[model samples]
Target: MTAGHVPVAVVGGGQAGLSVSWYLGRAGVEHVVLEAQTPVHAWADTRWDNFTLVTPNWHCRLPGYAYDGEDPDGFMTRDEVVQWLAGWLQTFTPPLRNHTRVSTLRPLAAGGFELTLATATGEEVLTCEHAVVATGGYPIPVLPAFAASLDGSITQIHSEQYRNADQLPEGAVLVVGTGQSGAQIAEDLHLEGRQVHLAVGSAPRVARFYRGRDCMTWLADMGLYDKAAPEYPGGKAAIEKTNHYVTGRDGGRDIDLRRFAVEGMRLYGTLSDGKDARLTFEPSLRHALDKADAVYNSILSDIDAFIEREGLGRSVPPATRYSTVWEPDAEVTELDLAAEGITSIVWAIGYRPDYRWIEASAFDGGGRPMQNRGVTEVEGLKFVGLPWMHTWGSGRFLGVDRDARYLADNIIDAHQRKSALESSALRASAHHHLAVAR
Candidate 1:
């Protein structure tokens, strides 16, 4: 075991972890970040080949760094994002120990924690006054229950596994989930000349455009996205709930789902009596389609107003809509891989936070750790980059910057107080021993 201690040890090297490390460096705090892979490795590896960020370049900045370039509103491709992060790391020069996987973390007798890290050569024990688990969620992918019942002859793949349209079978592909990933993946497959069927679930309410001289502009002007203090009540819960998932707003100029429907994508709702048995769209699907269109229109209206105000005519293009219901060019059916010869099933549902490495009893029945702002009930432990760690924006790229600063200040204060107490206790014990000798 290596005999050394650091003031703070951060696990995970994604956006959240890097943000914390940036602030820690600015504060001149001695710390080391442990990352199992290169920074932003998940985004670099998992996204489909045609994927681009829904958020514009401006919103993607980490703490103490802004996305450097002229095109603030330009969306970065997956590879571009990875390259930018690599460059940003060079500018900040955060002390990150790559390939060091932390196996477990336990509290020590004094105020701090002992982290067990597995390295390339051997196991190493490292202690820090505070342990920050900055592992952002989204690594573990969830699949639907019906997937297992399908015959083994059919090829199935989650959205995370999909890289491009070439991997899919020649016949129609059924894409589950209508979230940003699902919508984008379906669109990409359709572009590649494969018939695509989208399984509509609870659809997300999304903005139509990235930004313009309207509410979004106003929000940015007022610095609404900036980090803030944690003193506000109920602030933390709000921040945690703010969805970070991509949405329809990221579509480049002129693209609209209604227009895509008119051209040919099939939208299906929950299966009905015997329709699903035969792999067909449910009878009730028509009603659900109507409802989804209404939501889409509302988003489009807001976008239209913003476009006019900004005079971004060249950048913004007109959207299209399907005036009437149209049957699929191919056919919309329930996913039965074996019978239909379907090659892939993209699970665009979402991600679950896995905190198994944390053995502390601080977690509730739901597996969420109970914390007051960033402070947990357990001492010497803190959390950052959690949804709503303090306020509505707490977990946002802009929001997390604020929480990290506040958390750093609180940790510094706690460290000083604990040091003073330990010194006082040692002096008192020495005096008592001397008196006893006399």
Candidate 2:
């Protein structure tokens, strides 16, 4: 059977897809957005009830919809974020298909591409001149293989699966990994008076506010957010660095794991292995905490230097530094889970990208798409929302529009070139016919 066709097929209907659609619509490009789930479902469904954006509201800039809420500096709750995205959808009204899953995306031998989709009704095929994979980077949750060895009596959940402390059985909880989600979720449980034991990873921490303004504001002024991925200190490998942990909960604050230690929360090093009733950890908690502090202080020093260099020292608060509040006395390597009465374990390690459905030969040996600022070597194939796809903010709300605009421009250029070539061919054919008639 013949399949449906379009000029473009956008694979995800999240912010990335919507932003690209906005620009495409403005250019009069005919396209369809296929979403595996409902639009903005991640914001509406994946997050915990008390979850708020780590970044401030002003950063919520989609193509034409910038945040105009009363609280620009304040963070938006999960509900607010969902509502904000929905508002953008209403503005342009792109051709969106929810609950349509793209099972396979492969290049066509005849040109363009083919997408086999499984919708609620049944299976369908689509052919498109261009395909935009805006699925974002983090798709699959990751946990250690040892996670399965834990006692079945104890509850276990990934950070994405966690909602609140009350959902777990009443007892102490062991939260592993100190990334953004792990740190914040640990705080969530600790605040509720739950006994929390946190396994600290090497993820760095940054102060929420510095020198009379939000730390993000300081970084923005210093052009940290605008830094290109290639220009990063460690090169392309730097893009894989874990984000510095902080919090926007309770109207924004620093996540001081040290202070949490002082406040009775237990802290350990990275979790290494787990057995039926026992878990072991590497003795690196002290090193991890110190390393996080070093990054925090490094940022402060850079900002201070910027203030001095820009001659704006008097305008902002006097330069200050963080002093260690508490330290681990000794490395604690093992924990008896059953004896400690720990009823639940929350694994907040991180996520891995899942591109198994993409059957294109456009990836590197590491499975990452080989692209230059969203443009791939393969004709008419592009990716727009992966982390550090162009700049540090490429995948973020602050920069997705720029990436989309770039890709949209490329699509428009291709269309114009094709039209010109066809017109030139028509002129040549007309001349040949006239000569034959003479």
Whose TM-score is greatest here?
A: 2
Give the clashing pairs for model 1. 239-388, 240-387, 240-388
Q: Tens digit of lDDT per residue, candidate 2, span 1-438?
A: 237999999999999988888899888889999999988788887888789889888888989889998999999988899988888888888899999999999999988999999987899999999999999787889989988888999999999998988999999999999998999999999999999999999899999999888888888888877888888767866678888899999899999999999999999999999999899999999999999999999999998999999999989889888999998999999999889989999999999878889988888887789999899999999998888999888888988988999999999899879889999999999999999999
lDDT of 1 by residue, 18-121 (tens): 77788778767788999988787988788888888665567666666778787676677888888887877877877899999989898887768889998898
* lDDT of model 2 at position 245: 97
What candidate 1 gets wrong by more than 4 Å, as runs, is: 1-4, 210-255, 270-341, 391-395, 419-438
Cα lDDT for residue 81, candidate 2: 92
For candidate 1, which ten residues in a row score worst on lDDT? 271-280
How large is the C-alpha RMSD of every model relative to the true structure?
5.5, 1.3
User: Which regions of candidate 2 deviate over 4 angstroms?
Assistant: 434-438
Cα lDDT of all candidates, in order?
Answer: 0.67, 0.91
Clash count in backbone of candidate 1: 3
Report lDDT (Cα) of residue 194, candidate 1. Answer: 78
